[model samples]
Target: MLRLIMLATAGLLLGGCLQEEPAFPNVDLHGRLVVDQEVTGARQAQGIQGEYYKRVLSVNGQDMAFNDFVRHYCPDSNTRNETCIKAFRIKKIDDVSGATRFLPNGL
Candidate 1:
């Protein structure tokens, strides 16, 4: 009898844990950025360009905003150094239109 009761409780708990469907439908969006870093020499009053972040594989598979993705995943430091993360795949999410795209990086 105790085993039966335990089983029933477990089933109920599992059922409650199930997540509800999102009100806003999700979709994927894909794009790329030609990243370049420019530095201003205060003394020289001239701008020097550093090695630009290239071929940044961008995808919206997890449905994160552009800015959010940059902050959470592709931080500015990462862009500058490319050492924050060697490789990552993001689920693209469009804020205004509500679209989704998954562009996993091969690198």
Candidate 2:
């Protein structure tokens, strides 16, 4: 008798798990359009690689695509690679010697 009860309980549990869930009303009836985007050459260079993100910014009460004030270069202290490095690392040139305080390459 106990074995029969266990089998019945297990059957009920498995049966409940197998049922499909009902979708919400009007979900598919209303939403229909789908858009797929593919990244291009310039966007590929800027988006996953470029240091900063492009966004709609307010400049002088006008909206424009302006590059942020940033410098991208590989620091000498780190292993040089294709990855663009973002740093506040300032390049100061000696007024007298006319030589940079450090190696600064910004692109």
Best by lDDT: 1
Score candidate 1 by TM-score against the native: 0.28
- Misplaced by over 4 Å in model 2 are 27-107
* Lowest lDDT block of 10, candidate 2: 27-36
- TM-scores of all candidate predictions against the true structure: 0.28, 0.21
Task: Give a tens-digit lDDT track for model 2, residues 40-103.
Answer: 3455566554222222224345443212211212223343332212222221222222212243
lDDT, candidates in the order shown: 0.40, 0.32
Badly placed stretches (over 4 Å) of model 1 are 15-30, 34-47, 50-107
Which one wins on TM-score?
1
Q: RMSD in angstroms, all models?
A: 11.6, 21.3
Model 2 clash pairs?
none
